[model samples]
Target: MNQLRYSLFVLLGACSYGLHSSLVKLTTNAGYQAEQATGAQYFFGLLLLLVVVLFTKRVKLNMKQIGSLLGLGILLSLTGVFYATSIEQLSASMAIVLLFQFTWIGIVIESIYLRTFPSNLKLISIVFLWGGTLLAGGLVSGHMDWMSETKGLVFGFLAAVTFALFIFFSGKAGKGVPTIQRSLIITAGGFLTVLLFVPPTFIVDGTLTGGLWKYGLLVGLFGVVLPVILFAIGTPHIDSGTATIVGAAELPAAILSAMLILGEQITPEQATGVLLILIGIVVPQWRSKKATHPKKVYMN
Candidate 1:
């Protein structure tokens, strides 16, 4: 039952995150600049998180942790900017594939930091992930423009690096702090980081109009508040490695949502690539399960 609950949590979290990129795409198409949309999402997210913190009595911030949280927020904001910008240049499906490269980045970084090597399963999965991404992005689908491809590739890699940094720093900041408080601090950092770009005429120009506010509020509630709350509640009960793998589901979810909801087409090659990536993700879990239960003896 606990396992079932955890699986549900993971599924919900992945779906929320997956749907978020589509929302960003929609808002951007609806005449909101990338900066404005991103900024509004985080700002409203922070506001919602604060309200939760207040009601839940989880408002506590250690001064000592402030520096780390601030730094993390700045990094995350940059990550958001790069990702949002990439969405403008690349298809949501392609952009998501690139962004999910953070899984490999995280594994490499952790391995180096711990002075250890990745397990055989992890190594194989990493290889499969890159290969799958290339196929999924339709890199082989006829000639590509050198400049556009180069830019997309660079931005994609940058997105991965920055995302990995966000995860690393979030983990660091989360320690010794209540989950809600930690999330609030990080959200605050993201908000302030975006606040720096809030134009002087933001108020006078009526950029934050009623409709924008409504959409922004919705984005904040679903994209930020709900995911954070769900992940926080769920992660404690799940193994970190398993959680990370489960989270990868967001990649395909984003891609499929874009295809179905936004009318994006999925090429045959890309579909095959998606299947490879899924295999890559599943194989590791399968191996781990086998290793854990070496013999499946019948139970009476």
Candidate 2:
């Protein structure tokens, strides 16, 4: 029953994250420059998180902690830049499929650092994920444009790398710290990093007519605030491997949102790919359960 609750929380987190990508695409498509939108979102998210921190009466930050928080914020800023740029270059579905590669990257990092091997079930899950990626991404499609596809693929991979780094570093920074304070610091860092690049003209022109503030607020809530809150709450209850697999739900959500909201069509092969991805995600968790509850020993 506890596990069940954790699973639901993880699912909710994934759904929030999935919706975030689509909302970001909408704001970008609405003529807001990626930098402006990203900057505003982070800035606003920082404010929102600050409010939460104040309301909850979290721990006060020391000087050294402030420095670490600033560093984390910068990493998050880079993450936003890469992610937003990738979305502009690639369709959200393809971009998300690529970003989800962080799952494998995270596993490899854990295996290396912890000197542990993934279970056989996890190895199979990796295969399913890759196969599904190929199918969903139309790599098998004969008419693929190698150059454009390659660029998108490269950016997507970069996003995955950065995202993995963000997760790793954030976890490190948040150790012995409250989640709200950690979130605040990271958001502030991201806000500062983006501020360096966002021009004065963008701020001067701010209005609903310009669409920056509206979409910025949307991305702040959906992309930044909500996912952070959900994941922070959910991760403590589940193992990392299970949490990672469940998070893959974001990919399918991106694909479906692209189809319905952006009018991107999925070919039959892509549909099959989606199914494989879902299977891959589910298989690992199911296998984990089986391994943990092997057949009872028969007593004499």
* Cα RMSD for candidates in order: 3.8, 3.4
10 residues in a row with least lDDT, candidate 2: 166-175
Question: Scored by CA lDDT, what does every candidate get?
Answer: 0.68, 0.70
Give the per-residue lDDT digits (tens) of candidate 2, residues 74-151: 865676677666767777556666787887886676577568898887778788877887788676663544368667
lDDT of 1 at 14: 65
* Top TM-score prediction, candidate number: 2
TM-score of each: 0.81, 0.81
Q: Roughly what TM-score does model 1 have, to 2 decimal places?
A: 0.81
The digit string of per-residue lDDT tens for model 1 on 198-284 reads: 552443468777456766886777667766666655655644444555566666666778897689998888788778777766655
Q: Lowest summed lDDT over 10 consecutive residues: which window, candidate 1?
A: 238-247
Clashing pairs in model 2, backbone N/Cα/C closer than 3 A: 73-189, 73-190
